[model samples]
Target chain A: MSNISLSAIFAETAEPCLATPEMNRATIFFLIVTVVGLSCGVLAFIFGHHTIYNNTREMPWGMLISTYAFWAITSTGLCMYAAMSHVFGGTRMGMISNRMVWMSIICIMGAFATIGVEIASPHRMLLYNIISPNPLSNIWWMGTLYGLAVGCMIIEFAGIVTGLGKLALVMGVFGALAEVLANSCLGGVFATLPARPYWYGAQLPIYFLTSAFLSGAAAAVLFNYLAYRIRNEKMSTTVHLAVKSAGKAMTLVLILYSVATFWRLVSFYVGGPELGRTAADALITGPLALNFWVLEVGIGLIIPIVLIILSRLENMSMLAFAGFLILVGQFVARYDLVVAGQNVPQNLGWDNLPTHFSYVPSFFEFGVIAGSIGVVAFGFLMGERVFGKTFTQKEHH
Target chain B: MNIEDLEKEKNEGIGSLPLQERREFLKMGLALTGVFLGGSILSMTSISHASNQKNADMDIPSEGQYPYPKHYGMIMRQNRCVGCELCVEACKQSNHVPNDHGAWRTAIQEKITRENSTEKREFRPVLCNQCNRPPCVRVCPTKATYKDPETGIVVMDYKKCIGCKTCMAACPYNARYFNEEKYAIDKCNFCIDTRLAEGKKETACAAACPARVRIFGDLKDKSTEIYRLLHTPDSKIWVLRPDTGALPNVFYMNA
Candidate 1:
């Protein structure tokens, strides 16, 4: 690979599709939203989380935590897919693997930004997480692994951009491994909490990994569709085949995830702790019933699988639309899983407390969630503009 | 009264208890009942008077086998707590906990149940258990909350805390809260820096309590009231949520 200057990379806008004024306007719009959303996050720092957030002593984690998890899981899924496609070169999915790598990086940054604000002392986290490390902590491992994955992915992306194919593949392998381990650690954070019966046990780590693949596959189809649509260009035969392959992966994972989800809920009712049953009931029959039944179950799982079957993986628009709905469902699924686990009080019968605690995310919390979406949106547009050629062309080592 | 007549009578809840009558009950100082009210209520009521109970010894370690040089603990005579909240007030003052935000280092839990047209009320005080294996310490990403090697007391290093609230979720007792002023999670530190560092023997809440319900001492020391109270023959000694396997130092009894 030759030495490529930053100026040369910026000036070399070889792709005609991304040079349009319309694409520029869309990018600017997302940029403005990103600024507004991030400013809302900054407001929490100034006002203090206690005043700005609706999170109570009972429900300490709100919607932001779920959003962070959703984005992180998606990123992990994307990273793994990209690495697999690269390793198994000449597969239909390999055609769009480079684009997947780019989107994965963007999604992880979005995750970081959301969590950076959700936590009160991000600076302390950086400092003490290094100096006062706790090897036993699942959260500690998650943070460290994600950090390593990001570093590897960024270097890998650089290698891809600079035409260092061998370096890219090596770093991609490490990035994928880090991401997979990080994803499991994320699940461990919830699964190992014996205090929270709803989240306890060994099922959650595998459950989260399954979810990562689901979200990853959905994001692949959606982003690929958007890439073509944004450019007002027709999809190449290779790109079409790659998206179709992603659709097939999405359908398969959807079925597996549905089974996993069913058993997860069933296990709670069959001889589990009463507290755990009540927690599951929070989604099955209580306050979160609407979110669970409609968004998580009907929209996120069943409908998407049916749509894919109807389309027979041939209709591009149908596949993309189904992918969009799947993403929405997955988002709501994360929220339901987080909220339901904490709904039942720890000391339920002791205090004169309600059977289930109520938590409503504040306006600022929504703003931060929107801001994370904006980050991904803006990054997608910029990536298309800058790395348009790299994404569209087939790579060779 | 016959069972039919008792069932037919109107059940008066704690809401109907007169102020004078409540005061009289407090003066009487009834010992907490050790009756096990079924398996459903085991999480709320830990003490069991049953002599044949095999699980009673599981809540605590065997006698004279402590993990720390000074295994500090507290025993709450749950029945003596009348919900006066003097201890809560004292905790707030000592710990600098803000009242407006519902930030509490310790609090009272009032349980009212009706059985056969009779209303029964019980007040239970809760604080950080200072578990031998604290979940908060286990989940804290930065070792912000750690068990003091010397005292086995779970303490916080606020400067290292990231305020992730993972520790809060991991705590089985719901004993933690985010301290906005400190920009970190805070909980009952057993007044380590407040009174104990000042050459005092007891915590602020224990000292403020009028009913002598809060007993604070080193459980490793056989002479201390905490150790004696927990070891008394046939005493109904228990700790909350022993199934969590936290091996909490805090004891609840009717000593």
Candidate 2:
């Protein structure tokens, strides 16, 4: 409450905090789009849930759940990345950890918002999750830990702004741990099911963690490039190294995750259960062939790896482009994973059984996606304004 | 309610209202009553009209510990099913399931293979297996759905369910449905709450099947029909989707 403490909220650095008119226009545009999408999300609550959403008894989880997983997983990646850089300190990743911390908080907020609409009673989840804890449920852990990560990140970011590096570092470590555990639990939510054979596995916890690394590394490069470009400043050597460093990690994880994906398919065909193989077949040569072969496998993994290699990790624009493609592929990949897992009916021999339950996300679903994107964009712009100077300064080992 | 009275009312306006006003009044009244009666009718239809249980009413009250000395189960003679689907109808009425939801608590799937002559068409009545190790119970975050300690039935606490439908995905039988009316996940609990809670020994579906295809009784009771059926080594018995490892209480004969 003191004058010095209040004033200390703003970093006392000589660097100017300024945005061009074009930047102002861009912010306004983002704000408009966000508001429009938010209104659509609100409309689902206002009119009725069943009215807007195309989800049925057959396919309970629709695109909204997929979008939630997409954002939540991305947020986990960001937080983990931040924790690694700052906790170790004296690394290029550490220098950019502040930005990553801020975005991680924002991205999780987007994830929460999407799932907020998806769950029928989110308020009860908040209250009862504490009062009536179920250690057995993976979903319970996912929700509770994500909530913990978000809280810790907020305090850690505040500590960073206040020049309390030690406090921030400690909180960053806990926040990172929570995010990683929560990320694995998120995977366990699907992977723990014995009934859903496609999702049932011991490897998913590790697989999902690998995905987080890939998404997080790519995000670090893309957002960092965008941040510098918006400032109309040349890339600093330290920041360039940070961006390229992310590129290298991304290349490695993309290859590993792709191998995991390959084995996941191959294992199904080789003496896997009948229904499980049928589900796998849908991904290989059936309805989801395009999403798997083109977007998830080719564009998401291979293309980005190719681009990073061809650019020799030098071109910022190319790295960012690859990052963008990686993100697009992740989005589609999450959708296909969720949809494909449940597409095959439990009874294969039953008469009139649908090969796959059709789920084409309506515009309301798109609104939720747009709204989630808006959340990240708004938070990113705000972070630039608040911590612009801090992000520009370089920290060394 | 009275068709002849409605005809007379349409011909002559009631009280001081005009002909058009009277018609609107009737429409509004009918809509209100329809909404009000729709749910009650669904719940009460089978309870009121079905053939009554021969056993005297058992006025059993609650205890702190487990109440029932048995775990109830069903054995369906699959070949005996004539594909009448009356069991499906009885289940819907007993559970108060909505017709337009495109979901059912129980259903009959016909398996017609041309290779077999007499056994060409066979109806398989599939319901919630009430697994000993229920995936629905395990995956529920709030313990919203759980196993009944007394009956060993996988029952749902309607109050606790968040309608996440995680249980639906976890159930390999495809037995769970989200009730838009109750705003909860609906599944077969062997009509434990509806029939058994009210002193009936068997589910409405088991009772309603005229061909006696379904034999329902306590698995723990040696004298019960279901117990005898399972104890017999001569008859071949199987559960649906054994690969799921649900360990279902519902067994199918003639598989």
**True interface contacts reproduced, per candidate:** 0.85, 0.56
lDDT of 1 at B20: 100
How good is the docking of model 2, as DockQ? 0.36
Q: Residues A1-397, candidate 2, lDDT per residue (tens digit)?
A: 1245554556452224445677667767777777887677778656556668878766778888888888888888888878888867766677677888888998899898788877776666666677766789888889889999999999887777666777788888899999999999999999998777788889878888888888888888889999888888778888898888878888888888888888988888898677778888788987888998999888888888889988899998899999989988988888888888888877766686778767788898899889888888877876786677767675322
Q: What TM-score, computed on C-alpha atoms, does each candidate reach?
A: 0.91, 0.86
lDDT, candidate 1, A66-174, per-residue tens: 9999999999999999999998787789888988999999999999989988999899998999999999999999999999999999999988888889989999999
lDDT of 2 by residue, B103-144 (tens): 688888887777646547768888888787788888888888
Count clashing pairs, candidate 1: 0
Regions more than 4 Å wrong, model 2 = A1-8, A11-18, A395-397, B1-68, B116-119
lDDT of 2 at A166: 76
Tens-place lDDT digits, model 1, residues B75-142? 99988888999999999998899765568989999889999999999998999999988999999999
